[model samples]
Target chain A: MKAPAIDKKVLYAYLEEIKDPEIPVLSIIDLGIVRDVVMNEEGELDVTITATYTGCPAMDMIAAAIRVEMHTLGFKKVNIRYAISPAWTTEWMSKEGKRKLKEYGIAAPDKRFSIPADGVECPRCNSVNTRLISEFGSTACKALYQCNDCMEPFDYFKCH
Target chain B: MSESLINYTLHLADNALILGQRNSEWCGHGPVLEQDIAITNISLDLIGQARSLYQYAAEKMNAAAGKEHPAVTEDTLAYYRTEREFKNCLLTEQPRGDWAQTVLRQFFFSTYQYYLYQQLQQYADTNLAAIAEKSLKEVSYHLRWSSEWVIRLGDGTDESNRRMKEAVNELWRYTGELFVPAPYEKELGIDPGSMQADWMKKVSAVFEEATLQVPEKIFMQTGGKTGVHSEHLGYILTELQYVQRTYPGCEW
Candidate 1:
């Protein structure tokens, strides 16, 4: 018996259920890593994803998650493609996603031109006394910053 | 006309590829979840560098050969080549001595790569410049991570400091391979001599900050660029090339 066909809209909804294992607050779709989804003429499903960082360890797990999700949803012919060019940038992050990141205590990347090289405003306290501790944070994509006002160490999503 | 450009590219690629493979071996064995993720992240970055370099090499070879799709893609060139044909420097191919050693090797290599890529960004070749520009950002983080670990290990305790010092000493001999100019590199427009001085300065600063003594200069090990390599490379190739060698032309 042939497997049931899945629509792109339904596929997206299915994908929305897959949360980034590290940051459960953000869904893969919400993270903006899911670039595009297409159903080929032959009925095969193709999903394209761009990694937040080239060295992101999550890509493999993410791919497996997509495959497993689609399989359970009854799509047997699914292909995942990695798009490396034009590279993944923090700029692709959605507004809602940024809100979720901030809510989760991770400072979202600020407007690129607004912040000077010396420092960025504290996301928690809105204080300008924040200091740059390190360019790398807990993860490859985030920068470590300590807010003098809040006395909190937070991960700032580095603007690519 | 300079083979050094190609040799340098290959050396950089080899370091990334081999070290990446070693790090990937830690996939299921990391001491903790965060550390696992971090090591794997480094592996991914190195593999990405390997892919970029291999692709560039393939492109150059294709142009030279006048072939539509060069006979070998990066993956093939990466996995299928024999030990002697591999061009990674000796330092990267060494056994991961321990957590201390592994971190030290990473710190040393990343610091060196950071300086090299920063200089390469101003290379005469635009493509090389572009690749260097992209890699510099990644290597910068790598250097940061490594440097942090160096300080942690060196300043932590008696045992930690001793282990950190040992790691540095063991890996010191291979450090010279990073700066020595291959003949091809000298002929090509790429000159790494000045860059070597810059790299030493950066490395010394980091070492000083970590309160670790920088090893004095010693005789350097060579030969990866000339296709001669250490014994370790053979075993590395066996694992890396297994899939490609088993099923020639196989693709996902």
Candidate 2:
């Protein structure tokens, strides 16, 4: 007898438990790294993922986490496939993920490239008086910004 | 055909890795703390790109050669390759002479990559196309950032302009090697030579705004593509492969 196919809902639930190694507040599902999930002919789960950035060190950790999570979910074997086309964008980040990032003191990716007349809003003080400190930040996926009102340095997940 | 494809992929990976290593030298030595972080961050991205390409190359090599014991891996390909086996362009191996040289080198290379990746996104090879698509986004930022610096340096004060001009005179010769495709690149389906007109147009536009001249009639240097690199590559490999050479299979 073949193993029962894991439903999409259950698969997502399991994936949601695996938070980004770098941004613990955001789960891979909400972050849009989890693209698609399917069951292969052998009744084994196949998960497709895309890298947020080319050189994200967290990728390996995420893959390992997936294996561990699948094992706990009673799936003995899972195939993680990486897809790079139709490249990942900030738009894929869930609304809840953005909220969590803001609450975590890191600004979620902002879609607008043009600087508003007001300024970038600070995740901490909610003040639209922030300035870009550097085009890059602590990680390859973020840029450094400073809150003029709160005077705190923060990382902004780059819009890429 | 497959051999050419592997060589072509390795050529690109080597370009990214060597330039990334050179850029990382500015880690503590950047003109400013923020800029220092910026360059190194770019370096990380480049190295990240190298890792992906190397992984692809290694997979292809393993599949083709069917090696069993001591299976081929990205590390072995990166750390164990001889200097003559490197396929990076000569321009990437050039020393980071000064801020101007560093910035200019990045600007030129990023511009080339921007166009190259754009063309590659539609390539017949799905894997290469995917890598190009993923890389184009990061390359876009690098191009914009470096171009801005080029303008700033070229149009800045007399001293700054002098240094930028000096960099141009020294580095312009290496730019030619990028467009002249080698045997491997020729077999890879796309013609970098065809993109030269557009590349020159954008570069000229940038230099014009900066009131700088794109040196005319310089003797263009070539030969890094065929593993005929200058003295710089050996030095880079010595430091880069040292840890791996000293301790085989050392995990970081």
For each candidate, report its DockQ versus the true two-chain complex.
Answer: 0.20, 0.71
- Summarize candidate 2's per-residue lDDT along B118-217 as a digit string, tens digits: 9988888888888999999999888988998999999999998999999999899999999999998877666899889988998999999888998887
**What residue runs in model 2 are displaced by over 4 Å at the alpha carbon?**
A39-44, A114-118, B67-70
Write down the DockQ of candidate 1: 0.20
Shift in Å, residue B208, candidate 2: 2.2
TM-score for chain B in model 1: 0.92
Using Cα atoms with residue i matched to residue i, what is each candidate's TM-score against the true structure?
Answer: 0.72, 0.94
Give the lowest summed-lDDT range of ten residues in model 2 chain B.
Answer: B65-74
Model 2 residue A3 distance off true place after TM-score fit, in angstroms: 2.5
Model 1 preserves the real interface contacts to a fraction of 0.22
